[model samples]
Target chain A: MSVKLTEDMLKALPDSRGHFGAFGGRFVSETLMDSLMTLEREYLRLKEDPEFQATFDKDLADYVGRPSPLYFAERLTREAGGAQIWLKREDLNHTGAHKVNNTIGQALLASFLGKKRVIAETGAGQHGVATATVCARLGLECHVFMGSEDVKRQSLNVYRMKLLGATVHSVESGTKTLKDAMNDAMRDWVANVDDTFYIIGTVAGPHPYPLLVRDFQSVIGRELREQSVAQAGRLPDALVACVGGGSNAIGMFYPFLGDESVQLYGVEAGGLGIDSGQHAAPLCAGRPGVLHGNRTYLMEDENGQIAGTHSVSAGLDYPGVGPEHAWLKDIGRANYVSVTDEEALDGFRKLTRIEGIMPALESAHAVAYGLKLAATMDKDQVLVINVSGRGDKDIHTIAQLDGIEI
Target chain B: MSRIEGVLKALKSQGRKALIPFVTAGDPHPDETVALMHALVAAGSDIIELGVPFSDPMADGPVIQLACERALKHGTSLRRVIAMVKEFRETDTETPVVLMGYLNPMEAMGYETFADAAADAGIDGILTVDLPPEEADEVAPLFAARNLDPIFLLAPTTTDERIRAISEHSSGYVYYVSIKGVTGSASIDVDEVARKVAHVHELTALPVGVGFGIRDAETAAAVGRVSDGVIVGSVLVDTIARHQTDPKALHQALTDLLNPMRKALDSLAQ
Candidate 1:
């Protein structure tokens, strides 16, 4: 069953109370409520100001390298013998992922709000590196919270964050992963709300965070709008992107929401299989509940305790997804599916061999689903896949899985 | 009148401050929670705040976090916690029991169902640490219909406008967090707490209870001098953690820990 949405519902979402059709609301403690309201007001003001937009545009162009190429993968299209595949190369950004796009925008907002320090939480550490990079560029003190398990698994990114002059705190709480890291980050924000700004890595969290992040990251979709017209002669017939906390996917899907002809697919990490109960595909399998700060689809047990999630890619190993994605799924604006670890591995290898491009493990989930979807479509159709990040961080894990020591 | 309102009225008439003690249900052991509640009342506790253990407690420090972990290891759930309260009410119906925890477990139970079960189990009040007045529209009406007191937290950094809003939405006494940080954190400034309590009194007539960092009798007494009640949680929970192996010793230690603060609070009322 699909929910029918009015025109106003799609354009003016979240209303004034930060609710996206009961999926998103401020579910934080009273201490953090004031700060969130303040941030919401400031973000609303800055999003419409031309000066702020100008600064954001200039940073995207010169600092982080915007308008990344929309490349046609001829060999992969030929090998699949299906729809022609186009890649949005977000991997070539400054910090090597689509995460920096929002961080740059938020870091600028933090400066404009006169906050001297910024804090973030990370799972695979891509977000930590991106936040540290922007904070370093803007001359702000940065703190990144990572789970102790992730700190060990992604040690190189930990060092990279430190090299950029950001302090890294290893959270030793529940599950010791992305969820715990986000909890600790919220705790830190509550404690230091006077001088600190929290730069959430994804389009999740309470209220204005989802709205603000989508607006900042919508630059990807805006650029795609222009690029698709110029390069592909029109909008692609379909769009595909991986969903962790759903930032990159929402960024790629927001501008195309009104394009009824373009089909959207969001691929989630199917760690083992749907029946195995080890996947992080919340939208595909989980139920709606309150977690973190918002009411969204969450992987939780019967008693409402957040269940431990498994994904070969650390970035996608989260229990809850962004609330807007939950809304989109409910309203039938987008389709959500999953790809198993082995399928993603196959995608990684096929992209590397056929197109000479190394896709991140997180983005490989999208590639896997895209190939499957393309094979079922006509050969003349166009499918655009978001290469959300580079694969440099996953080399060690991939090598270990392949029975090689590096 | 409700047990909570009655207790506050009696305490005020007797020129005494309320001594509220917090303990996680099923901590140390699942079967001993009722006996612990009785022991707390015997140790001069005016109200009992029973913690429903959750996997993630963002506002809590190491001590309370460890308490929740120990309770969860015993497979404690919100339903079991309510049953414990029901068991406690069988022997003693005078002492008001407040259920306190995060919002997820109750949310999973559904607002109307949880509220009916909680009232049926003889629960007097509830304080969800993460649910502010802004997000209480769904659950607050159900609580009011059941005549359950909906308590809220007021931090040191809360603004005047928000304080007024919280005062309107809240039914039971407002919990004033003594410090800006999480529970069990150190460095409590008594004068600052007094000023904030005075400001809170100016906004609302509801009784204000100071909590979060009152570990010893001295701090409890100092806080008691300004607020209507002093809530001690981490110190008592830490005592339970220390005597996890010996239930008898745990009971004695909890009583011993609360007796002095109880005496100190009484002397302050004098």
Candidate 2:
């Protein structure tokens, strides 16, 4: 499953069978084969249709508040003292995260498929809120599976989901985290495959999911490309985004793949540190294996059991990454790194204090790494970090860490 | 012929539907697995489908998930499960053993190495729940090279064309999942399974073994009348969960649960 693809093949990848050089094929049970095939077929047709594209574009403008600003972080740039740091303001999106981009697109696909019910697996509740928001708008029944641990930590988001009229199922299975939530959602989708549309929260899962999610979320990079040229007269020197299941990072990285000059970096959560063997950095420290549905880098024990991962951010607490990121890392197209929990918290604080903009803890990982990378560069060079979500949902976690009553 | 083929053939000739019992390896304790295997054979199980516990069994319900956790708690690994099979093979070589689980463990071992080790440890067949026919194209030949029957599953949603495709790749009996959901989910519609099993028989000569939702002797007997074999799980694992404290009660309870199903399957003999 660890085969490598040449540079040219990476451009037209996933082939026909969804293999990104031995990753991202359909590994689901036989029951799901037909539904997935149908989804792939419909997605292929709709992605090319003019009307579908127009509606999606309109929804981005009218509903999701698209073209989220690409702002120059003047203060952070001055603080870094080496590079001109810019922030892709995905945090300003309607649902307060880049997750809405993919959810709205998938919700439209679900409606196109005539599916009345939608199911989604969420880790930090951001995706759940985003998905529920779309389902409410589309008049579809929504079910969101969340790990029990995350449900407790992200209780505010859980209430937000309920207020949006989505049923939240607290998954108590496995480690009670993101991977188990995905497992439970898969089971639910299998049982109700006829009526349910599984809106995967990331750029992971089986073939069409990674492919479709990437296509939907690629708006981030597409917009950033135009925004970069308009703001700085050229593409930025580098692009940085945090990778939980690699959705936002891949979204920000896809359109820039052909731009040979713009370097890309993906930041994975380093709970303690990579050397501590407790982080969720699969690309850095793990091996290639099948989990969920695609063959990607996974954090597994010697016996192939999925290992438990630790990250202060629930969204980044997954065992496997998107297969495309795995391909990107293997082919030397992009760089993958990890930032420790302490560093991410520091990034969270620095961004809020210096820039007056709070970032989701997941995005703070990229901010944290970007700060280090910026400091090592010349002041004339430019770097852009994707602030993928607002940190309002993380206030409880931050307060608890600081031992504050709030 | 492979051991799985031989057993299914003998059962077919005798007009007796195969009664396949499934148990997770090292459940309760690793030391007790071999004894449980022997007890299952003594209770007239035709073939033993031993589950290799996985951390994330997305296809299984709570019963099997808890069973996997129990097995893993005792440090059960793929090699350990294979070693347990070798121990079972020491005395009883006739009853075929089929290793069943998710693909990652076998994949971690590498297909060639896993195939070699499994064949050496007396494994006759492999049923990776997550490896559909599309993805099995790579690993099927590796298992085939080692004469390990690569078993595939047929879901209710599987079309006739797919049934042919899956049958072409499968060497041993193709398991027909009786329901649409995970293991231990919803009751099986006997008539619906009979129709699907009959459809499968028309497409391929591979024996159809019905599983998932088979709980009692009556359900086993109903399903046995249509398919060539009946695979029982979850209920037996639930029993093990109940009697986990006492080995004697565990053995007795296993035998007690399997004995009636065995008799029910045998009663269908012409």
lDDT: worst 10-residue window of model 2 chain B: B261-270
Badly placed stretches (over 4 Å) of model 2 are A1-11
Interface C-alpha root-mean-square deviation of candidate 2? 0.6
lDDT of 2 by residue, B85-136 (tens): 9999999999999999999999998888889999999999999999998898
lDDT (Cα, 0-100) at B253 in candidate 1? 90
Looking at candidate 1 chain B, the ten consecutive residues that score lowest on lDDT are B178-187
What lDDT tens digits, residue by residue, belong to model 2 across residues A177-205? 99999999999998998999999999999
Please report how far candidate 1 places residue A191 from its true position, in Å: 1.3
Worst 10 residues of 2 chain A by lDDT: A1-10
TM-score of chain B of each: 0.99, 0.98
Model 2 TM-score is 0.98
Show how many residue pairs clash in every candidate, following the order shown. 0, 0
Residue pairs with backbone atoms closer than 3 Å in model 1 (clashes): none
Tell me how much of the true interface, by contacts, candidate 1 captures: 0.61
